[model samples]
Target: MSTTTTVVDIAPVAEVQKLSLRAADPSESKPEGKAPEQEYRYAHLLPHFSEDRYPPLEPYEHVDPGHRALQHPNPRSFLDTAERVIEITPQLGTEVRGINLAELDSDGRDQLALEVARRGLMVFRDQGDFINRGPDFYLQWGRHYGRLHIHPTSGHPRGYPELHLVYRDGKQSFNFEVDDSITTTVWHSDVSYELQPPGLTTFFLLTAPPTGGDTLFTSQVSALKKLSPQFVAFLKTLKAVHSGVEQAEFSRNGRRGGTVRRDPVEHVHPVVRRHPVTGDEALYVNRQFTRRIVGLKREESEAILRLLYDHIDKSADNQARVRWEPNTIVLWDNRVTAHSANVDFRHLPDARHGARITPQAERPIPALEGLDLSA
Candidate 1:
């Protein structure tokens, strides 16, 4: 595939160089000093982090997590450092214990990435130690994997552009028509509209209501496998268009108060994408961003997408749920999973707030049969 020149403004050369050097030498990737402690008292304020103008972007390339995992001399064994790794379900999530994410070396990080690639999501509990290490340490840990992605319109803390704030106050009335369940409209991978979409996302819950704020993760790999062979084959031959126009418009004229720095984008991606590390096929379209299948008529695309979406929604065996607690961190690979939050806690007195750091990975690769993807 030909490489597209980058809009240097989106990802600066110096920034890319720094992340590259860090990836090459994991020992040097650790942050120098602990960041001053910050209180989570400001959960109610929705602060938009945006630049004055965002230059238009063209497609660019980067080494994806799968390729990077393969480069690790021993990617599979890094999990041996964990005290215990428990599979949450036959197909979807894993709960890892006794591993401090802030302390993982390069090899450990690589293996963790590999594990998330293979498993849809990994949950680590009682992560207050890592969470308290502050944004500086957290950001550095994310950068070690890849160049961090700045969310086009999400609220960020005052100085940190890399930290996307997930703040919710229970008092705000419902903004849209009631769906009866949030999962109906919210199941999605993070930012699928980007040329190079997000790979691994770190979501750390800092505060939570005592109950009712759980996230549901669906394994696209498993979702695809459950289909009949003929259907899967047909899906492989198709591409879908994912768009960011709704999100951009929301940022500009909706509740976000015009926080968009990067222009909203749209791209065509394989309906079935190949996992970079595991060499597995996954259903990639989500209800949130995926607009339509490229070659189909409007009705045909809607029918097909609706079928896939319903499959993902009803495949109970392919899903896993993570109940949240303060200081719990869930790391998920967007390449293989789609997730949604249970907004049930939104009506509770307590606020639901968290910090998310998503690192961009390679452009989606079509899992075309007979293609030499080994390169």
Candidate 2:
């Protein structure tokens, strides 16, 4: 493959050099009244902590244990710290655990995030601790990993003024009325219409119907791996039309009293994308926003797109379903999975309310990179 200009950012190199020099100097003394050289020598060998000088570590005390306790009343059965990988079959949509999202430290959060990314989707049942903060809490957790995505037109209700609320019962909500079809759609990645779409989305379900409403997620990586090599090669060469304008327009019409206008929004992205953190390549196209393939005639594009969409739709074994419980939360990687809501309980009297925080992607991974495809 022909290589493009490799632009390397060197801003951090200077700081790294300074730290190295400081560490090399054996005579570099500690601040007044600090520990002796012998005592601090061992600290320098630590990964992040240097023995020579000590900057007060940030207190983890701000992380309240009560937060974890509230989320997991009985930690024994509900909470397990050891890493776990479980497949959620059709029969088991929900995974009940004591993993408290609110109590996760930086390392814990990273571990959980990776697990969620790997598993496609995860559920935290009966998260009463999160309900009070509601959407605000979700925003915090989402932003912890990356920046919150601000909609091109609308603003978030609380955080970013430009991010429009997608909730139907609130200031800017998606209408779940009898006539709405947008929210009831099947298997799709969120906001694929953008050039660089969202990385992850966190949803907090504050309320749920008495029975039958659930969310399903399908693994895109597994789906792509099953495709024939010929089809995979063809897909790699093609780009799909995804439109933000179409979704915005749909949202405008779907929400009651929403003033947002529909525009001719579209973007083209590769059928497969490489994740930044995990370095794993995943199937990236979806049926919802993906309209046609570029570099092909209309008929050819339609035929190819139809087949690909059908493949993604029919791969039921790769999917995981989650039955909602009150104050429950779910998070999934938008880059690697497609999801749908089961609206069987739409007629139920109880309202399902929740907030979703989508983090913006830094860049789109091109198809023919030299980096390892399996990371």
Candidate 1: tens digits of C-alpha lDDT, residues 278-366? 88899999988999888788999999999999999889999999987555789999999998877776666565556788888888888
TM-score of 2: 0.68
For all predictions, the C-alpha RMSD in Å is: 11.7, 20.0
Task: Give the range of the ten consecutive residues with the poorest summed lDDT in model 2.
Answer: 1-10
On TM-score, the candidate that comes out on top is 1
Tell me how far the alpha carbon of residue 371 in candidate 2 is from the true structure, in angstroms, after superposition. 13
